[model samples]
Target: MASNRRAFLAATAVAALAAAPASAAPADPLETTARPRPTTARAALAELLAGNRRYATGGSRHPDEGLLHRHALAAGQHPFAVVIGCIDSRVPPELVFDQGLGDLICIRTAGQVLDEAVLASIQYGVQELHVPLVLVLGHERCGAVAATLDHLRTGAPVPGHLELLVDEIAPAALRTRHLPGDWAEHTMRANTVWVRDAIRADSAFAAATVTAARFDLDTGLISVLP
Candidate 1:
């Protein structure tokens, strides 16, 4: 049954893909925004991965940014996934995933830290928007992780409200200290896992598939972690 469901989803995604070029000058305008959305979490993840492949290989279609599509989306948004990521300027989720207007609901913080507001926003996406997937995206050599590591080691005060951000990421920095190799990278991965787990544990949020991933800056590739 699972395989059959996957096959059906693959066909639906193909139908959606074929409709992409028409979005350049969509006849109905809203038609582009109405493509068959991934019905399951695995299918949604696959779509995101496919988009990332296009982005990494320099073959992005840059779908759904057209003026007509923008106008159509003014009526409503039905994004497929909720991306929880870091505030790093380099890793814009839309660009990295090659998705466009109304395709993803994104919430970003330094180290992808979760607080009440972030959790609430994500909950709204899953419960109200019925988004199938929630991805916590971390990246290589994350600045937040590095800062937390340094601040924790030195016991120096971080300036301004930035201390709150570092403090949120402190657990990952401390947890990965015993691991070999680069501290920041390990902490970043650990932090993504922690955030993913936290979201899963949150009773307030509606049911959705939660996952963690890492993005490599040099390669422009994103990988889902085990």
Candidate 2:
């Protein structure tokens, strides 16, 4: 069932991408102001979850992509949420959540690993931009977490800066070793939770809410973890 869902989503993504125009000429700009931003974490999270439901059910409205929206965003962006997700080509936050321009502050890293720079970027979003919510989004079949599991089991050396990813993810892999499920999947969820907790613990992010979620590659659904 899961595999079938995954195949369906993959086909859907391909069809959508193929049907989309290569480029669109800018539409006449509308004289409009930016929409009101979500001021509370709960409100921000509700907006994201609603968008995800639209995407999962194939009812995406593709809002905020018009020329007026783009032009308004050029002045300044007040994204309501900060999404920390994997750098997977297939799991773009915008498309997955069905959000458009200036709706989210997206930060992607392999395995959703956090370093000084990633942390700083998230901090900026929460503190400077006053983004109300931060989402740590992990997905099924993450190559980075899988590689870390491989390295742990085989004691193999990963060459170059890629090893850094393995190193950061190793702790999550180790922590979840005793759990009764697929190692990679477990590690993915664990990593997401770990990062969420880390962000919540950070002093700079105290004003914002931090949460973790797993993206089902098969169904294109995002399940928020408790």
Candidate 3:
């Protein structure tokens, strides 16, 4: 009789505990944190292009640059795209796309060349960050392409590590030589396309959408290439 009473008391306590409201468990860190941006590659591409259009029209919204957004991103980043662009001062990816902080993972090199470091950065954006889109952006009258063309035409050696840049861009210059446009412009577009194709072919970037475009200096317009 004593054991039965003890068992009954234990059952009552357990039932009461079960019936009691779950004291809202401390908020889970992962659940409480800001959710990542939900976007598809096509959507991300469209958003970027729209931002570029706004910037070109002098109507940039400059979204997500405020204090609250910055603080939220301090906890974690959820950029939607990875932009591989030139190191040109005139062609800042953030400004050109009119995107604000945490909008893009930008990887820049002269002529947008992809060495091991650049490739690894891009892979991180695609594989880890899950950025939906990768954009290879080149600009008109790119000095890198021009220098490569000059070097190819003159066979003169470029000084120091600058020659590395010329070497990387030379293939594109050579490939576009027979095309019927201004050499620099043709090579610029070709270089963008070449890099885009290279990124697209990477197994690491297989899940991400990759594309190329050229930024027009005079018009401030970005033209997506075929």
RMSD of each: 14.1, 12.7, 14.2
Q: List lDDT for all candidates, in order.
A: 0.89, 0.89, 0.88
Please give each candidate's TM-score.
Answer: 0.84, 0.84, 0.83
Q: Give a tens-digit lDDT track for model 3, residues 1-226.
A: 9999999999999898789775544544433344345389888888888889998999987776765577778899889999999999999999999888888999999999989999999999998988889999999988898889889888988999998898788888888899886989888888899999998888989989999988989989998999
Provide the lDDT at 212 for model 2: 95
In candidate 3 the C-alpha lDDT for residue 91 amounts to: 97
Q: TM-score of the candidate numbered 1?
A: 0.84
Report the lDDT tens digits of candidate 1 across residue range 46-134. 99999999999999878888777888889999999999999999999999999889999999999998888999899999999999899
Encode model 2's per-residue lDDT on 23-119: one tens digit a residue.
Answer: 6534433324345667899998888888999999999878788776777779998898999999999899998888889899999999999999999
Poorest 10 consecutive residues by lDDT, candidate 3: 27-36
Q: Compared to the true structure, candidate 2 yields what TM-score?
A: 0.84
Off by over 4 Å in 2: 1-36
Clashing pairs in 1: none
Candidate 3's C-alpha runs over 4 A off are 1-38
